[model samples]
Target chain A: MTARIATITSGKGGVGKTTATANLGVALASAGFRVVCIDGDIGLRNLDVVMGLENRIVYDLVDIIEGRCKLRQALIKDKRLSDLYLIPAAQTRDKTAVSPQDMIRVVKDLKPDFDWVLIDSPAGIERGFRNAVAPADLVLIVTNPEVSAVRDADRIIGLVEAEEKGPPKLIVNRVKPEMVKRGDMLSTGDILDVLAIELIGVVPEDEIVTVATNQGSPAALDPRSRAGKAFREIARRMNGEDVPFESLESKDGFFGRISRMVRPGGA
Target chain B: MNSGLAVKGVGESLLIHVPAGPWDEVLASLLQTVVDGGEFFHGAKLGLQLEDRELGAADLGRLRDQLAERGVNLWAVLATAQGTRSAAADLGLALDMGRPSQRAMQPDEPIETELPGDAAVLVRRTLRSGHHVHFAGHVVVLGDVNPGAEIIAGGDVIVWGRLRGVVHAGAGGDQDSVVCALDLAPTQLRIAGQIAVSPERRGAAQPEMARLRDGQLVAEKWIDEHRR
Candidate 1:
């Protein structure tokens, strides 16, 4: 099956781009689809670590591009999933080491083997970001529910359109359901109003996500995780399945109700 | 007398270098030259290039105020003089052209053909954030101009959709040039020399026309009867 190259980018840093990439890759692969995740951040590599495939990496994206290793050799197989793989970025190299055309070529080579290739773009609208999106058939802009993150998402969406890699989809990550209910945080509607792009998924803020990430395991591996369920739904949607968005009220459950009753106006 | 002043179009704006001489007399002559030009050089972005003249903060600030009072925008101050450059930098005027000029010749005749003019190109898609449209003639966009996108045209511009980006019309030297749109609320609008921003719309949007009026940029509703 030909791979659909999807790049996840956020203009601002530490907004869960690498986390989303790892989770989405795992979620897609677990559904019996062949998936590969590429860490586009050159000098600062994190996708490999996030996916927990750091130690297995013998060759990397730069090696593949530089002809030092075969593309298959660069593909580090995940310990948990046979179909899931990662082409880690070299920590010593900078963004200029790999060009946009090199990325396009690498993705083209993987297109024949994998069903989906998710690229984790570096923060800022610079060379690394361009390289990440160069081969993307679809772009997913990740943003938090804050004003600055939303604004950066808007900017990234614009750049995506400029490069003709649009129209990009948006994933609003780290959304606190209680805050949204209290009207303290920007809701899905508020984000869609400003961005004007198609909404792909809204990953709610879950403590499990933090714990799972710390353990170098994506939240998607846990079936009981709320964020994991959201990611699975996103993967299905990406595969052309029409999955309805999870209702926020149902997400909170009884524990959420108790907290809301006690705090009343807590964010 | 403002006899020694030599003005020329550098990029999209006029450049007037303040030659090393008596400050008081040169300033007077420069102001007189601007006044003599009537509406020709009014509301222009003038870059004063000082090669070696030292200027203090108060001197630069006073000059900026004086230029602003006369409808001129002091956008840049090019100086080889350390003190002058520092003063200008403190005032936040650009020291150099960060990017090369994207300039071309203006169209002499209106292009009514379907092929469009050689200077400008018509865009039929929405200009989202980060999209930039640069043309040598008038730009006619049939879609929305979102924030962060920019349009630079050498002639008048017409948008059949919402305009919110930074647009500079009449990039050549036609002062009577205008910009029209279905909803003409730009982040910033430039016509020949004058620059202005769209006032916040009270309610619904209507077809509007923007032009220089009394040396100031103004926007008015476009009526079908006033096609002429």
Candidate 2:
């Protein structure tokens, strides 16, 4: 199957780029698609740990690029999902160990085999960012609902446009809906107003996500996770399905009740 | 034979024109000139103009490192070749000398002649954050200018949509230059030497024009002649 390569990048660090990549890979693979997630952060490798495949990595992306290992030997298959795999970044080597051309060459070889290739990009618009974007057929920008994060997302959108990659979709992660209702946090509308891009999904802040991540299982695998459900919807949208956006405000506990009482109709 | 290299001062930096020659010879002569120039080359910003000379990222990176070792900063690279331009850009080098007219034209010196037709750039798309547009003449944008973007024009500036970015009109000291926008709320606005931050809006946005009045920048509602 011809795979569509999607790179997840956020200009700022600690905005759930790795978490989204890992979760999306699990969500898609659970749908019976062959998926491979590559960690593009070479020096600070974390996708393997997040994906719970760190101990299984015999070879990595740098080794495959440098001809030290075959592509099959480097791919560490997921323990839970048979068709899901990961090509972890080399913890010892830095970003300079792999070039943009090398990334393009590696992605080219994987295109015909997997149904989806999700690349987790490093923060900043440096060599690592360029390398991740160089091979992307689609780009997904993840951001938190804050001024600095939105500002950085705008910059990344401009750079992605400059690269001539089709308009990148947006995923607003770690959104505190209760805070948004209280006017303490920026709403999804406020973010979309500035970013002016297509919204794929809005994930509410969930403590289960932290538990799931640390347990080496993505939130998408947990049936009761709010964020997991949001990720599943994102995966469906990625597969060309028409899933309507779920309202984050309706689920907020006391704020939801008060808002509904004030408006008379569901927010 | 001539070494085929030329260097001249431009504002705060030196513009070096690299002549069409063998890559090795060109680089060797460039290093030799820097060495021969002594203290003049040290701590100086160099803008290398390579007209149609193709160079890869490795070559440009090496040259940048070599220049850095000599205490010379490689600020910009002006090239006509696509390969060379992309290489320079990938290396985080400025592609052109931005807003040269800002320094060249003196505010006190008045223009003595009127051109046949004044020049202006018409941008048809939104200018997002980190995007900068600098022109020597008027600039007319048909889309929104988001915060963190900037426009420095030597003449008047006009925006058909929201104007929320930093903008400078009459940058060359033409106090007569004005800025007009449908939604005239920029992060900061400047005309000639005067600067102002947009005040908080009390209601809906409306078309407005800003210009220097009695040595102070002021914004007035844009009223059509026929409607007035």
Candidate 3:
């Protein structure tokens, strides 16, 4: 089966792009879709660490692109999922080691065997970002609800439009519903009005995300994690499933009650 | 009208001329130019230079009527033939445009009026962060101007969509310049030498126009200036 390449990017750093990529890869592979996660961050490679597969890396994406090894030799099969694979980035070489053409060639080589190829793009709109998106059939821009992150997302959206990969979907990460109910933070509607794009997912700030990353396992594997549930919904949506968005107010707490009282129409 | 129309901007208005051709073809060609001009020739006084061509009164009247339908005024006719001049006179059209200076030298006229000159640029895309749109003329954007973006115009700036960026409307020190947008909550607004930050927005946004009021930038809801 031909694979659909999707690139996850955040113009600002620390906005959960790599985390989203790893979780999506895990979720898709768990759903019987053969998935491969590519670390496009190059020198600052973290997908392997986040995916809990850093110890088995004998070859990287550079080695495959440079023809030092066969395509299958560089692919590291996940310890849990037999069909899932990880292609770690080279730590010694910078982003210049792989060009956009090289990314296309590598993706073409893997398209016949996989169902989805998820590329985790590095922060900033540079060569690394270009290499990640050049082979993408769909682009997902990750951003925070803060003003600064939204501005950078807007710039990246403009650049993506310039590349003729228009109308990228947005994933708003680290949303604190308490601050939003207090009228102190920007809401989902506010961010959407500024960026003017489709919303794919809204991941609430959960401490389990930190726990999952620290343990070198994605949160999507946990059944009780809120962020993991959100990632699962995002993966289902990517698979063309009609999944209803869960309300952030589902957590019944003192803060949720105060928020519902403050804004009666809030979801 | 087809796009085979030659439109040239003269001193104050447009000069649309036609070469030697058939009566139907020339009229069609001339009318096409006026129609294809779109907003660029809207309400513009046109001088149709029909070099030595002879035309009937009904033909000239039909052309004038079509131009009037598009909001274009056929004010002057330039021709050497007697028949064309007579047709133009029958429709109350000017035989000669005279000198452009005569219109400028008219007494009791508003000489300081802002003429539609080379002082406006229409941007049809959103201005994202790190996008600097600096122009010596007035700036018009049809999309959003997101935060961290900056618009510097020597004249006024108008945004058809949201304006949340930093905008300096009168960079050339013209206090009369203004900034208008569908949403007027900009991060920073400057006119001439004064600078003002937008107040925290509450409730809903409305179309607002910001201009210098007593040497300070003041944003007021726009509710049809003619009605005001």
Candidate with maximal TM-score: 3
Q: Residue A157 of model 1: what lDDT?
A: 85
**How would you encode candidate 2's per-residue C-alpha lDDT over A234-258 as one tens digit per residue?**
9998888867665555565433443
Score chain A of each prediction against the true chain A by TM-score and list the results.
0.93, 0.93, 0.93
lDDT of 3 by residue, A73-100 (tens): 9999998888899999999999999999
Which candidate leads the pack in DockQ?
3
Interface CA RMSD, all predictions: 1.9, 0.7, 1.0
Alpha-carbon lDDT, every model: 0.83, 0.88, 0.86
Given candidate 3, what's the lDDT at residue B82? 94
Please list the residue runs of candidate 3 whose C-alpha ends up more than 4 Å from where it truly belongs after superposition.
Answer: A250-267, B1-99, B103-119, B224-227
Candidate 3: global Cα-lDDT? 0.86
Judging by lDDT against the true structure, name the best candidate: 2
Ranking by TM-score: 3, 2, 1
Tens-digit lDDT track for model 1 on A140-246? 99999987788788788878888998589878899887887778988777676567777778888998888988888999999999988888988998888867665
Task: Order the candidates by lDDT, highest first.
Answer: 2, 3, 1
Pairs that collide in candidate 3 are none
Q: Give Cα distance to truth, residue B121, candidate 1, Å.
A: 3.7
Q: Could you report the DockQ of all the candidates, in the order they appear?
A: 0.30, 0.51, 0.53
